[model samples]
Target: MKGRTFKHAMAAHCESGTLTALLNHAGLKISEPMVFGISGGIFFGYFESKKFPFPTFVVRSRPGQIRTALARRIGVKFAERRFRNPADGEKELDRLLSLQIPAACQTDFFYMNYLPGHVRVHINVHFVVVVEKRGEAYIISDCYSPELASLNRDSLMKARFAGGSFAPKGFLFYPVSVPEAIDFRKAVWKGIRSASFYMVKLPMPFLGVKGIRMFAQKVVDWPRLARDTEHLSHEIMKINIFLEDQGTGGAGFRFMYATFLREASELLNDRDLLEMSKRIMEIGDRWREISLFAARIGKRRDLGPDRLRELSGLIHERADAEEIFFKELLAMSKKKK
Candidate 1:
C-alpha cells in the first residue's frame, strides 16, 4: 500500500468513474463510456415525493446496478461489504487501505468537504474511492474533483452512515478479480439491447421514455408546488445542473452513451452502430438545448404559463425522438444478434 499508486482522473459520473478507476487499477484498461454502456447506465425516471424538497428527475439507472450489471456481463469479481455499525465500517476501510486495496465507498454527497458548498447536496448514493489513509484523514478520489482530495475520518463516517433514501449504510466495494480477456462484441450488444428495452419496453409509466413524457405533462403543474416565483425558478435551473453539471458528462448521459456507441462500433467493426452513434449524439445535442433553454428562462424569472408550455413542448419533442431512436436501436441489436 505504501509503494503502490492509485491514479486519479475526473469522470462524468461518480459510479461509472469509480468503476472504471477500480477496473483500471486492477489492470483492466477500459474507458468510462465503455464501462457505462456495458453496465446499461443511461435511463430516465421522474419522481415526486416527500423525500425531496421539490419534484426531481433522474437520468441514470439505480445506483449499484452498474457494478452488478458489469459483473454479470463480464467476468469481474468484487469484494463488497456493508456495516450496521459505523465503527466497524471505519475499521474495515482502514484494513483495506492497509492492505493497499483502494475501496470504493458509497456515501452522502453532502459530507464531501472538498466540494464547493453550493454544489453539495444530500444525495446518499455518491461514490468515492479511498486511495489511502493518512492519520485522521483519508485520501479521496472523487469523480467530480479535478485532483485527489482529503476527508476526515469523522466526516467520512457520517457520510457513509447518512440516513435517508438510498442510505449507504457504510457500503464499500473493490475489485477482487477480472478476467485476463474480455469479449467486447457480445458485451456491447447485450448492453445496448438492455438499454433499449428499458427505454421502450419497461412497464412502469413513471420510468424510461414514458417518464420523460410524464415530466413534460406534469411540469406545467410545478408552479402550484413552488413556494414562490424564485423557488420555482431555482428548481427549473436545477434541470441544467442535473443534466450537465451534476455529472451526466453533458446531456444527462446521452453524450456519454453516444461515446460508448462510437467506441463499440470501432471495436466491433459495425457500420450501423457507428451511424447510430452519430444519431444519439444529435439527440444529446437536443437535450442540451433543452437544458440551456430551461436555465435561461429560469434565470430571467419568466415562469409564465406560455413559457412553461414551451418548455414542456421541448421536453416532449425529446421524448418523441428518444422513443424512435431506442426502438431503432433495439431492432438493430436484434439484427446483430
Candidate 2:
C-alpha cells in the first residue's frame, strides 16, 4: 500500500471524525459537527439486556447509521464491505490503500494500543481510519488519540473481528464520490427537523427525552430495587463517568449539538436557533453538575438515596428543557419550510 497526504485532526467523537476526514479528503471540506448534525446523530437510548451487566445508555445513534444517514442526505456515494474472512478483508483494505484511498474501519477499542489500559474495554463500535499500511503496522487516525498511531497487523485483525454484539466483522467504508456543491441551508433544515422528530416523536419510551426521564426514575429507585447496593452504585458511577469523562465533547454530546445549532443559526440567519443553542449549552452544564453529584454519591460509604433522588430531579429538569427546545426547533423548521 502506498501513502498519501492524509491529515489527522482531533475530534470529539470517532464516527463523526472519521467521516469528517473522509469527506475532507474527498474535497467536501466538512467538519465533524456538520457530519454529526447533518446525519441527525444526536439521540438517546436506554435498554436493559441480560447480555449487559446493567442497563445500557447511549447518547448517539447506533453504529454505522451516521455514515449512511449523512450519505443519503448529502448526495454522497459510499461503499461499505464486510467480510467473514479476515484475509479477504485485509486484501480489500490493501487494495484501497494501494489506490491511496483511506478507509474507515470499525474496531474494538480494547485492541487499540494507543488507548489507556483502563479504557480498553470490550467496546466494538469504535471507528478509526486506516490510511496506510507500513511494513508491519497499519497507520491509523483515531479521534481520541493525541497523535497518529500504528496498529500491528495482528492486533488490527483482532480489533476488526472482535466477537460480541455490534462487532465490526472486518467492515470497511469509504466515499466513492461526493457532490461538488451542497445546499447547506436545505441540509441544515432537514437535519434539524429529523433530530427534532426523533427527540420528540419517537414512539419508544426507551429513547430520546423520554429515555432520559426513565433512566432518572431508575436511578432514584436504585437503592431499593438493587439486589446489591455496592454493585449498583458502581454501575451508576460508570454511567456518570461515561456521560461526562468519555470523549463525548461534553454533556454526552449536547455541547456538540449546541455548536452545530450555533453554526446553523449563522448559516440560516435565524436568531431562534442561536437562543436555543445558548439554552442547550446551559443544559449541558447542568448535566455536568449532575454527573459530579452522582460521582460524589458513588464514592460515599453509605447508600445515599436522597442524593440519588436529587440527581434524578436534575435529569428530569434536563428532559423537560430538551423537550421544550426540540419542540421549538421543530416549529422553527416548519416555519422555514
Candidate 3:
C-alpha cells in the first residue's frame, strides 16, 4: 500500500484473472494447475508485503458444490482500508494477499464452498501452463519475457482457461495433481505486479503499507489517531519502561533513542538522509490527503475550524515525530560523512 513494489502487487493480478489472460493469451501450451492457497490467506515468496483487502467469497462446503459454479458462490465482503501497527516492524512476518475471483461461476474455483471445516487447505500455490490446443507447446515460461511485456490474445485465452493455483512446489500434500506447479509463482506474481495505481492506492492506505503514513497519521487522523496516539505515547512510554524493566547483564547494546540517533548519525550519508527526509514527508502528506478528503465532503458546518486546528495539532505532533526522525537521521548522516 505505501510503496509500489512488484512483489507486493502480485496477488492482485493472480486474484484478478489478469495474469491468466497475460500468460494464456500468449499462445503457450498450457498445462497443469498452480497451487495458490485458500481459507487462510497465503503469501508467496516475497516479504515486506502489506495487507490487502479483497472481496472474500464464503462458500458452503456441500458435497456437490463444484458441479455448478453458480450454485457454489457465496458472500463477498468489500474491504475497507485497515491501519498498520508499528509494533509489526522487524518481527515475524504475516503474508499479504489480494484477490480477483469471480463472484460466482466455475470449472476451477467454486470448490471451496463445500467444505465442512472453516479452514480448508485448498491448494497452497498455483499450477499454470499455457498450452496452445495444438500449437508449439510454448509454456507460460513460454510466454512473456521481461523485454516482451504483455501477452498476445490467443495464448492468453488458453492460459486463462487452464489457470488455477496448485499446492506448493515439491510438496506431497496435493489432494489433486497439478502435474506442473513450477515457474508460475514468478509469472503469476509478475502479473499481479502490473495493475494500475488507482487500483491499489485505496488498498495501500488502508493496509498501512506506508509505515510512515501510519506513523504520521497516528497523530493526524486524530478523529481516532489523536486519542490513539495519546494512548500510544503513554503505552510506548510504558513499554520503554518495560524494556528496561528486566534484569540486565548490561552486556547487550543499550537502546536509548539518543544512542540510536547517535549511532545512526555516524552510519548514513547525505543521500541516505535526504531519502529518509523525503520519506518522512510522505507521512506528512497523509495529513493533507485526509484534509482534502474532508474538504471534498464539504460539511463546513460538520467540521468546525476548532476541530480542524485540533487535527492540525495532531499532524504537527506527527511533524514532531518526523522532526525526530529527521534530526536523528541528519545527525547520523553528518557523522557518517
What are the models' TM-scores?
Answer: 0.98, 0.95, 0.19
lDDT for model 2: 0.85
The superposed Cα distance between candidate 1 and the true structure at residue 232, in angstroms, equals 0.1
Ranking according to TM-score, highest score first: 1, 2, 3
lDDT value for candidate 3?
Answer: 0.25
Write one digit per residue (lDDT tens) for candidate 2, span 1-337.
1254888888998999999988887778778888888888888887888867677688888788889888888899988999999999999999998889899999998999878887777889999999888898999999888889989999999999998999798999998888888888888888888888888899899899999888888876666556687886787777677777666888888899999889888877989889988988998888888777777777783457677777888989989988998889889888895
Best-fitting candidate, scored by TM-score: 1
Ranking by lDDT: 1, 2, 3
lDDT of each: 0.94, 0.85, 0.25
> Highest lDDT, which number?
1
Off by over 4 Å in 1: 1-3
State in Å the error of residue 124, model 2: 1.5
lDDT of 1 by residue, 83-125 (tens): 9999899999999999889999999999999999999999999
Clash-forming residue pairs, model 1: none
> RMSD in Å for candidate 2, one decimal?
1.9
